[model samples]
Target: MSDKAKLVLGDKTVELPVFTGSEGEKAIDITKLRAETGFVTLDSGYMNTGACTSAVTFLDGELGILKYRGHSIEELAEKSSFLETSYLVFYGKLPTASELKVFEEKIASYNDVPEGIKTMIKAFPKDAHPMAVLSSNMVSLSAYYHDLCAQDLTPAQKDEVIVQLMGQLKVVAAYAYRHSQGLEFIKSDGSLDYCSDFIYMMTGNKNVSKEVAKALDVLLILHVDHEQNCSTSSVRMVGSSKANIFATISAGVDALWGPLHGGANQAVLEMLEEIKNSGKDYKTFLAEVKDKNSSSRLMGFGHRVYKNFDPRAKIIKVACDSVLKTLGVKDPLLDIAKGLEEVALRDEYFVSRKLYPNVDFYSGIIYRALGIPTNMFTVMFAMGRLPGWLAQWKEMVEQSGFKICRPRQIFTGDTKNTYIEIKSRS
Candidate 1:
């Protein structure tokens, strides 16, 4: 190890003595960090830590670049299918022809979730959110497969666990959506491709055009994995505790259901509906977003990590235009979204912060076009992200020296407050 500490900022570098404290103590230890996993940054903002270099997605926040298993996201979205991308993320390579065929068959075969699971889903409250139903159902699956927890599961069985769970998430997602509305659940058609099948399952009528299905396919593919993202990180953190994949993934689904993370798409649509109900023009709404006094932010217009742009947003924008044109469906909210994107991209505050639209920006539009309810948006996200969580869980179990995640904090509360006598009231 180098004795000197090197600090590189932008193009400048400075060397200082390595930090070490007095006898039997330590000042700082840079050796513990996994620098190769991503470009190291010394920011006072937040410290994101994880394993050393690993095979998975790569995200460059400043450049707005995302790659999955060495393939550019744009390329994958345009040229690859969702199932193929998912296989790559999990297995670390694009599947061969036979492998791809077998994988597809495996997933399609498991499309039907157990009737007991469906029955349990119906017992949920009618007004329950789809994400909640989906998460609860996923945890319930643990009971059905409790035997796997104790047995020495084989590698092939592990693969089966991931593939089946990926397929079953779509079933659970669709069932939750239709169940909440008291609509009859739609069954999956084996002939239809993955995205088309998901759409068909929600909407009994299979009227989706080939072009629209293709766009939806790409959307699902692009969203399949984002390395070390909040929810994925949560999944790995929970999996580190030796939880089964189903339980760990359920935890991830619950985490993603939060408003600040995967639920942003649903929140964006709700915000748009609110803006429309306000009886204000798009320009007026844009003005409100700009007004610091209002403290109103344009939902889906910015991201926490992607400082320059959100790559998924770019792909979905193209799909949005295509789907709208192909379906000839026009909603006033689409126009508002376009206008907001234009205004936010050019504004100084957004420019300075490098804030741009994210995946949530166009996702709601696509869901609306597909006849999916706005409330089910995060369910769709959960469906797509399930594979990523499983892959991370498997990788963590197979490789990393995993342990239960219990972070420590320095306590600054009253150290020696005396307990008052209950009988001696003042």
Candidate 2:
């Protein structure tokens, strides 16, 4: 195999070194392309770009494989708790029993937020989107924990912040849900496990079913990390500027608020609701999705990275069914979701295109079964994704020869326009 790729610009030729990842993925290093050739590659949306090399998560979209710290996501989801998975994603190894206990204790210790954060949550209008409340409160944590925002943090200080964020984000997510519903906030006493405690706080139900908590834990494990996604990229971009961890995570939260990212699950729920309310069967709606002229889309039916199938979706789908059965919640939207998935799986139009159900499809169903409102869906995503964002930030700052993210742009607009006075302008 060639160690370098040859590029020809007019009569000049240059060799760019080739880099290969552990998973056999290859990229031609273009670090010096613009400097040597006075040109840059144009990759809109960064679809083919490798922003940074990472060891936190490995995603083989073509094969529908996802792993954290070299451990398969399936194993983690089945055998490990969310907290355990979080430790693996952040620390790059599965924790021993004693190490896990210490990690859990540290997370539980920081579960409660300061009173000012509660006040901040109350100040938002009841109708404000939970993502807005989440992002705002996430950034405000820096004001409460000065060490988290310090420009120069010791390794111990950084570790503490990681633990603090893993714990507090769950509390904030529950608070955002309660605030949106005009309910009183429930404080975590740290008696239950991470997912159980979150369920207790969100619903004020001390004895949430173990199955429900475990299902939520699985969902969180599934979402812990995905290569360089939009939100993770946002975290890296902000962290590259030497921004505080709180602010960097806040940027990620804001990015996840977009419908194209973390809000995907919420959109899936809305699509199900629309089908139910319209009195249309899943087949009828899917027909519209097949029509090129119709604007209707089969939300959660496909993924950007996983063209074959979403590995997380396979796990979450089972959890979704189990939760529905355990809760005995007769939700019509869930029925509609199930119907859509059943038909889409065998439908040639969908099969040929590989438009299988992704993680977002059934996650909303599980959340709904757990009594989580639609608006709070993204908040749950932010909570699950907290560890991933922190891990990405930590990796960026700790990397050797770290450079701030500054992408080059090809300007197409007029560059030499003469300035015109306001009165003379047409």
Best by TM-score: 2
Task: For model 2, state the Cα shift of residue 42 in Å.
Answer: 0.7
- Residue 121 local lDDT, model 1: 90
Tell me the tens digit of each residue's lDDT in model 1 across 1-426: 566766675776655445532222223344433342333335332355443334677777878888888899999988998899899989999999999999999999888778899899999999988888888888888888876564346798789888888788889988887888789899899898888888888877687688878877787887788877788888977777777777888999998988778998998998888977887776677778778899677788777779888899988988888888888998888887887788777878778877789999889998898787889888888877887787777777777555666554445598897778989757
TM-score of each: 0.87, 0.96
Measured on C-alpha atoms, candidate 2 has an lDDT of: 0.89
CA lDDT of every candidate? 0.80, 0.89
Tell me the tens digit of each residue's lDDT in model 2 across 7-84: 999999999999999888899999999999999999999989999999899898889999999999999998999888
Per-residue error (Å), model 1, residue 66: 0.3
- List candidate 2 segments past 4 Å from native: 290-296, 345-353
- Supply candidate 2's per-residue lDDT for 403: 93
Give me the overall lDDT of model 1. Answer: 0.80
> Which 10-residue window in model 2 sums to the lowest lDDT?
145-154
Q: Please state the error at residue 329 of candidate 2 in Å.
A: 2.8
Clashes of each: 1, 0
Residue pairs whose backbone atoms clash in candidate 1:
21-27
